[model samples]
Target: MSLTHLDARGAAHMVDVADKPESRREASASGYIRMRPATLALLAEEGLPKGDVLATARIAGIQAAKRTHELIPLCHALALSKVSVDFELDSVTSCVRVTANCRLNGRTGVEMEALTAVSVACLTLYDMCKAVDKDMQIGDIHLDSKRGGVSGDYNRADTYTEQPTPIVAASAEAGRVPLALEGERTPSVRVKCLAELRERFGVSELSVPFHELASANVAGLKLALKNQYERFIDIDDQRLLCAVNQSMANDDTPLTHDDEVAFFPPVTGG
Candidate 1:
């Protein structure tokens, strides 16, 4: 299908939704932030430096939903009727899941608003706990569902499933080389640089072989990039953001050959 944000001449422009009939629209989005067990314990006990982490994050999410149009250039401003942010703590995974919902009677969908809420909430959680847990990861931000839009409704469960796919073969075959060979001909990780990182690095995408890294982890990946290119020397672990397969990741997060990795600067305005 054609993208609504593009005109027939393939130039970027806002889609005119003024002619569309107004309807009550709602959207839900979710994400999570993972941290150390000790950090989680501190958070549970309200012992962290930041006071009331969840409460602050919830408010941040709600505010983000209301101002999403200001952050995203093409989004239409709407009079949102309701916005809510909820947090669920999971001890087993040492993570907190954030879910946000937005509703409004308008011509446009509130999907971006809901997504912005979740994203900002996760980021706020990270910011609050960073003093004690610099290795925290924010990830899995996605739209869970939407309703009342002209495109109908959508539920993530109805369209998506988590299935592990093999990313590399065990050994060589024909012209292909095995990742197990290590230094000989290791498989590569697909790396993407987003936002300002793309401009700083002068390239949006590149690949790094598994063998080039000092270790199979996020830190290793960053170090390898810095070693290969002098301009990457400015990459800072504490300030930079990272994701693996669209989920937030920390420096110690392990990696395998052929994994999709992204690095970007900390986001602002949700």
Candidate 2:
């Protein structure tokens, strides 16, 4: 297929929609910002250092939708008729989900505006919570649906799959212990330090024997690393974000052998 934003000579250029008939175009996009439970609690209580995080993020999203053309090149500016940003807090995942909807009676669809709004809203949430939770993550930004234009309407499928929670069994001495599933073997935990943390550690990835950890949880691994390396002495837990098996996790999150663990500072982007 020919690229809409490229000239026949292959130079990048904006698509001219002057001849096309204007239609009522609408688009919706969604994303999420994951943070610590404590940070989420603070936000729920309106006790964060930044006042009214949700309200600030909503306004930011609306503003971003109106100015999407300025941020992204080769995009046509449209007089958006309506834009709305909404937020939902999920304590189970300790995250805030953001959705943005944009509508305009124009030749081109408003998908970019909707997507831009969602992205900026997620970033705003991260910014508002960064002081208390440097380990937050913004991700899963995508277009949920679009309507109007010759391309017809589009709707995204609900394909998101939740990560399986770790299984645990009661132990008389250990209280609760993660038990390996039948036919599964967990021998070690893979550790990764990302971004600046990777540079500080001088290594991107390492492995820790599950048994070697003082305890079989995220906190135990952090303590073990601190005890073994002087570089970890200055690292603060509140400033570090963690993921276990590709899912956001907290210090008390359970761990088993062969689990992938990632440590990194908070991510930033528009």
Best by lDDT: 1
**For every model shown, what is its TM-score relative to the native structure?**
0.61, 0.59
Candidate 1 positional error at 60, Å = 0.6
lDDT of 1: 0.80
- Where model 1 places Cα greater than 4 Å from the true spot, the runs are 161-270
Error in Å for residue 56 of model 2: 0.3
Tens-place lDDT per residue, model 2, 155-251, is 8773244232332222111332222332334466767666666667655665665777879899888886666565567555596777887567998
Candidate 2, superposed: residue stretches over 4 Å from native: 158-270
Alpha carbon deviation, residue 264, candidate 2 (Å)? 35
> How many clashing pairs does model 2 include?
0
Report lDDT (CA) for all predictions. 0.80, 0.79
Reference-based TM-score, model 2: 0.59
Best model per TM-score: 1
Steric overlap count per candidate: 2, 0
- Give candidate 2's whole-model lDDT: 0.79
RMSD of each: 10.0, 14.4
